[model samples]
Target: MEGWLGLLLLLVHNAAAAKMKIVEEPNSFGLNNPFLSHTNKLQPRTTPSPPSGPSHLFRLAGKCFSLVESTYKYEFCPFHNITQHEQTYRWNAYSGILGIWQEWEIENNTFTGMWMREGDACGAKNRQTKVLLVCGSSNKLEAVSEPSTCVYSMTFKTPLVCHPHSLLVYPTLNERLRRRWDEIEQSLSDELITEQGYRKLLREIFQEANYLKSTESKSEEKENQKGSKRFETLEQCSVANNELSEELKRLKSILDKNGISYKNASDKTVDHLVPSNPNAARAEERFHLRGDTGDRDDH
Candidate 1:
């Protein structure tokens, strides 16, 4: 009996260990495991906010002429004196392609660059290619030039050169409220007793109070307008109802004076009146006996 009890305990322990091992395994489908799928699938991806300053990239393309060819053909010599038909190349950021002949850098709206044409495999080349560029906020490709033979220059517009303060980022309402609350808390906790501090605090308080007052006043004005309009509508309806009641009374009096009676089908009271004139009495009796046919003349 002792041996049997020990075997039973061992079997139970093994079973419990196997169950724990299964539970501890990572779930591949993420359907039955809460621990493995705690992240929400519907959550949106987080993206970095845009920089608070102007920044831009531009693509440029154009032709180039050598100094000798330009001077003879156009009477103006180009900065780079390449062979007559050599094409000018500039880096295109969008295409991720660099100009084979030139390398350039731009900083603080100033541009400087160097370039050279490919020659025969074993040839030494001159470093005569230089470039200058200028840019502004208008976002226009303003100019391109070659100051000397085999050199180039260009001017264009870029937002990145604009001042940081000019860029705007609108905060959400919750964020704005949180920031305002933080500011208020900070102001309340400050112990500085300077005149400037007092003035600043008073200004902020007054501004907040004024904003609240304006909102309240606008809402109250709107409610008052709505109430006044409703009141006017009710008064008009009441006056019209009174006029209709008076008209009905006048009509009923006219009917009574002519010895005519009116009754609704839904009325429980049944009243009969005797006509004073014999002719009217006969007509009334005929109307009651023969219904509407008594009122129609037989042609």
Candidate 2:
């Protein structure tokens, strides 16, 4: 029995030594080890990487900002949704989702704004907001405006949106020139000036800086042309004034002949008879002066 016990103890010691050796041995395969295969099989829980670009507004993700304009309060959540609440005594006066996060607006390879879309409906289309991200010391919602029905624009300021040399005290030379060009284009579009006038203005812009100051250097012919333009303008004004006076006098004579007081007439009716523009007034005066004789002559 003692011999059997010694043999059993030796067997147990050998098994224990083998187990210890296996545990102490370094895993040469590292992750590929059969023992660690289960660990490798388990996929890692991936955390989303931060948004990449000069404007790192991803730091503001999941954060919210608010602004109040008049009776309405606007709430903006980065990488989320925007909402508007009407101020009232009740807990829920009027609440609406303005927009949902769509994508980042990129300009010049930099993130400049956030576009949110597909919100509450307005007419046939849905509401949307474009939040312009500007640099500031702290994150804030500056203002919210609905430039059109169901379309919203927001000015949002955050330090995260700031980039190297983003702000400027004044516009660049190119910007100023572009603005002037736009103004000239607008003038032409508004019919405030003719095509010929636009070209003249353009030429004046490109002329020497002292061109306006050197009026004395102009030729006599050019001076005479300028005087003619002025005289023509004055003559037109005088003609329009005379026509208006004659029309008024004629109306007054007729009213007196009928023994009707001018004061009793409706001002609107009088204004209707007297056209707003000189051309229209002239046409109206001619029509009245010719009367039935003109119609018979036309036939």
Candidate 3:
């Protein structure tokens, strides 16, 4: 009976060692091993977030603007979906959702329009609409029309989308100041601060901005005095003057050594001598006269 128990123990130990070896190296059993296959299938995956609308377009979010026509009324919500309604005497009946926000249509590094698709079915394919955003005094759904079968076009106008064409294109000084004033006004309108507080804030801003500062304000005179004090000591003034003189002398010596002579700087502003930002300046043609970049759509 002892001999039989010893043999049984030896057999149990051999079976455990073989099981451990298999567990340590699963590849030796081939890629068909169930344990290894299960682990390989359990990979971590990340879910992607939805795409975002442009800054100018995002400002109109949550507000639904409508355009009423003789037959139907159209509604649009920025960064959301659009819908059409049948104009009834009692209440506007829901026609159908025109389209949902998909992606932005960009041109020349600017978001010119938006593509809203996967909406109500027309016949075979689903409805789709292209919304064109333009600069205007206020937000309005200008118009809507069906260009092709089930394909629609919409024109939206808002001041928030107003921006210069390119980085090289700069707004006029009046436009810049107007935008600044609008920002201040918007703060007050939003009730972010009281009127008196905003006025005080404007005064502080004006004091900091050299060009905007009042001539009658003592702060302007103080700024002038501060600038003058940069060379308060005679020794400091002499050092600056000597440094400028030396720079000019060195520049002149180099020009003379190179056998190059230039006339004195012109008294005029010499605006023509300054290189243009865009060397080959091309004026944007009138919208009607321009070539069809395919962006043009009805309404």
Candidate 4:
């Protein structure tokens, strides 16, 4: 009887040990996780790893770094997706459409750098985080442009995720984007307008008073910067005038010595050379003579 009881006790102990659940909870894939305290299988431990190396956050992608090198032509476009179910990251770059060189500020792995749209002014306006997705028939989602432009962005698991709403589809989109960029560069390399087109443009530009004034203002600004007329000091100007006067006197003396009739500059009159009936000249004379001393002869 005692031996039978001992045998039954041992059997019960073996069964209990075999079926015992020591750890409270585990991952769905059957990996034992120490951070999890729940008995539920769906929940997994998310405690920060020691000496985090991208897995806790992420790592830099070298290929993405090159995409943002040109700030002028591209803008910030982030592609968020998953890798092998364990990794999820964002590939960031410029939108590449209607952006400029200065728009790209290379920070992060920078698959895509800062966004520079055509109208983006300063950091305030130009930073656009475009959604990355594949565009095809399987899924159809509303475009962010229709209801809200730049109001929000999406993080996709794959190109297939955003396929419905996305204009570009992952790797295919990359080639399309590159081809489009190449075409644009080729087009811009050539003179955009024909001679006739340029002539028409010039005529139009000159005909508009506002445009002409703007151009004049720009030209004047350039002149002011590069070839501005510097003011001479009073002493320098006075000395120059004195030198010119002496030079004139010497020239007159030379002419006299040569037996040529010479008149002093002030004594010479330009009235006889005037065209007598020039209205434009009269208007110019009136404008210039407003503050002129009457005795001073202008030759």
Please tell me which predicted candidate would have the highest TM-score against the true structure: 3
Q: Of models 2 and 4, which has the larger lDDT?
A: 2
Instruction: Give the TM-score comparing model 3 with the true structure, all chains together.
Output: 0.38
**Which runs of model 2 end up more than 4 angstroms from their true locations?**
1-55, 90-92, 165-299
lDDT of 3 by residue, 4-110 (tens): 99999999999998888434533423323334323233222211113343433455678888998886778887767777765553322346777877665533334
Question: What TM-score does structure 1 among the candidates reach?
Answer: 0.18
Off by over 4 Å in 3: 1-51, 89-94, 165-299
Top lDDT: which candidate number? 2
Candidate 3 residue-wise lDDT at 284:
12
Q: Rate the local accuracy (lDDT) of all candidates.
A: 0.35, 0.57, 0.56, 0.31
lDDT of 2 by residue, 179-288 (tens): 55466566556333445555544433322221121232256438757765343577897886675566566655543433334352563234334444544443344334
lDDT (Cα, tens digit) per residue for candidate 4, span 55-142? 2112211112112121221112222210101111212212212222122111121222222223223245432333333334432222
Regions of model 1 farther than 4 Å from truth: 1-55, 58-102, 106-133, 164-299
Go through the candidates in order and give the C-alpha RMSD of each one to the true structure. 37.3, 23.4, 24.9, 22.1
